[model samples]
Target: MDKFKKIDVEQLNIVDENGTVRLKLFNNQNIPPAIIDGEDILPGHRQSDPIAGMMFYNTEGDETGGLIYGSKKDEDGNYTTSGSLTFDQYKQDQVVQMEHNEENGKKNYGFSIYDRPNTNLREDIIKDKEIRDSKKSENEKIQELNKLWEGNVRRAFMGKNGDGDVIVQLSDSKGEPRIRMVVDQYDTPRMEFLDGEGNVLYKLPPEE
Candidate 1:
């Protein structure tokens, strides 16, 4: 057994037997870009405003998911902080995540599950960048991007909102809330069932 009393490192990587990076821990300055299929996608984008965290990689060197956290305070006493743990779908974005976010005096924390399409995210990223850089109008670009990434949906969320309300929400496949249970800041508990159009079709108390 070997041990070092004091070790300081800005970045560290844990590699598998095949020399593939399985896990990486890094500081903001040393954060690595998102790597997929042995290629760095959107290089330099993450480094521009990096957060200190560790990233997980799959056997093929694709980013799986990671934990990230950071806090910053401006000179005027305003502050922002956030932390997140995520598990990504293969070749896609996060399918499950727990997150905490605070900006100024607002705070929100939640665990959520998402449904993503089978489309490869690497191709979507490249296409998104192209759409942004295209000569098309802003509205046209937005429409195209929306159509490109349509199947990404938040399926469920259970957490405290910025307004201090505890909420458990379940949505349909189209991302419409079908059920919502909440305990508001005032400690009033209520449950509601909604239609696809977001109309409250039923309530616990019958709305009497």
Candidate 2:
């Protein structure tokens, strides 16, 4: 075996004994699409999608989750960068995630957790991705995707915001944040209850 102090490569793939792709590392110029359970995710790309990242596969070659990062600068000096670490629930959706993002000087960092129904999230995502790719009006696409999320996965979000505020939020089956508790930058704490349409119904410790 040859030993080297360091290795530089354009791309790398780690496969399992059964020749299944367990992990992959690649340069930003050549990024691969998402694959789960040996099934490829629909649509090769999204609007300014991440350019580089590493993906992980489960025992059955299903994509459990990944960590990805991307950045871009345009001629007009506008720029955006983002990174995310995620973990998918078995047979469901991404139940945990940590993410950081910056765009045109605006920066944010947060993490979240979700609860999904029994449906296979991998399939649901693929189907939704394909449906999203259909050549329909932008408004139509949004409406269609919303249909898929109603009463599906999505449950809660608990994290800190860019403003240094920590929050715990609960959602309804339709993926609406119905409740939220927050500790602000100055450590001021408050809680809110909202209706399904996002109208605030009440607040704990009424405002001064």
Candidate 3:
């Protein structure tokens, strides 16, 4: 079930003209015009499909928006809300799925938004090595690891001045890996890595 499940056209300003409906806007307010499928809503995307679904344009047409889907009960006690979006797994966009339950006049909305990139550790290894070798300019590499393995393990890295540093990695209950480097002051210039639990995982070899 996706999040865009429940909607009401009247609640969202979806108007009926002849047979086709269009979203109306206020003069001063700036928001994406919503798409209506009967009473269902489809929010516009921030990037692609700019003018296809719903048009929230100014005099010049600078569109910034996202999709919104919904569901609601009718006077006859029937519920309806619907819309859909296609996604490429590699595109790095998020998917939101939703489900709703209504009984005795009380409604419950449940949803999940998948926001993580699929794992290909082997491909990531080369990228990780590049980060390790590059002069430690930004914390992005470390942060990437943290985000990549979040909730699965504790990880850290340690290294030193010249060479011969061993990388240590550990996994938590979920078997996600985080790295640690162990190197001495005499090794090729590098910093020490420590895990969230403050455990030292790797130590670099002594400089020759």
lDDT of 1 by residue, 71-142 (tens): 888799988989999999998989999999999979999999999999888999999999999999999999
RMSD, each candidate, Å? 2.0, 3.9, 20.2
- Worst 10-residue lDDT window, candidate 2: 39-48
Residue 46 alpha-carbon offset, candidate 2, angstroms:
5.3
Report the candidate with higher TM-score, 2 versus 3: 2
Candidate-wise lDDT, in order: 0.92, 0.78, 0.38
- What's the lDDT for candidate 2? 0.78
Instruction: Compose the digit string of candidate 3's lDDT tens values, residues 118-208.
Output: 6533344446677767777669768876665443332222211123333343434343333334343354434334455655454344333
Sequence-dependent TM-score of model 1: 0.91
lDDT of 2 by residue, 87-148 (tens): 98775557888888888877777777776666776678877888888999999989888877
- State residue 129's C-alpha deviation in candidate 2, in Å: 8.4
- Alpha carbon deviation, residue 170, candidate 1 (Å): 0.6
lDDT of 2 at 137: 93
**Candidate number with the higher TM-score (1 or 3):** 1
> What is the full ranking by lDDT, best candidate first?
1, 2, 3
Model 2 misplaced regions, further than 4 Å: 46-50, 121-148, 160-166, 185-188
- The order by descending TM-score is 1, 2, 3
